[model samples]
Target: MSLKIALFGITRDIVGTSVIELPAPAPATVGELLAEMRRQYPALGELRSCAVAVNNEYANADQPLHTVDEIALIPPVAGG
Candidate 1:
């Protein structure tokens, strides 16, 4: 499974990269993906809030995933 995810802001800091591949035998849904991410990157779990997008649209936890889908992780942003 080759699901690539783009990361922004603090998510990048937590993951130490702007993009990452979902581990082999990819998650089937957004929630599963998040759980797996927190497993691999515990720092990601510390964030109070984060947003996930699939194919450029805001996604829900139950949203299905596919190897072809475009994914992104958005961390909460503070407006100055």
Candidate 2:
């Protein structure tokens, strides 16, 4: 299955794109996707923190991923 991930903030900068296409097996987990992201874009691993969202809702590490899901990578944010 091919998942399209929307990138935000520093994630977009690190990935150099607004969207990314990740190929994974059926029913991939959030953890698995994250591991693959770190492998494909090591810079993403440098962030202080990152969050994954599916269908506009925050997802847990064990959450299952679907091919039609709308995934997003949200990097850490700092404000004074």
Candidate 3:
């Protein structure tokens, strides 16, 4: 049971990939998952305005997660 997280914007650059998959027995909550990722990729911890989306909807820190859940990292955007 693993969690695959889609990466977008700066997150993709920071993580150096479009997707990141956690090893088996992934974290149970959004916050925990993010925390685990941050610990692995210290650069990700530098992001101050990132959002987590689950199954196409914005997710909170305590949102429950499953191995099949669709997760995405949404970073701030800017336009000229």
TM-scores for all candidates? 0.89, 0.88, 0.89
Candidate 1 local lDDT, residue 19: 94
Off by over 4 Å in 1: none
The per-residue C-alpha lDDT of model 1 at residue 53 equals 92
List pairs with backbone clashes in candidate 2. none
- Candidate 1, residue 80: CA error in Å? 6.8
Candidate 3 residue spans exceeding 4 A from truth: none
- Writing each residue's lDDT as its tens digit, candidate 2 over 1-80 gives 88999998899999999998876553388988899899889999988988899999999999988888999987876768
The digit string of per-residue lDDT tens for model 1 on 1-80 reads 76899999899988999999877788889998888888998988889887789998989999999988999987787889
Segments in model 2 whose C-alpha atoms lie over 4 Å from true places: 24-27, 78-80
Tens-digit per-residue lDDT, 1-80, candidate 3:
78999998899998899998888888889999888878887888788777789999999999998887889988876768
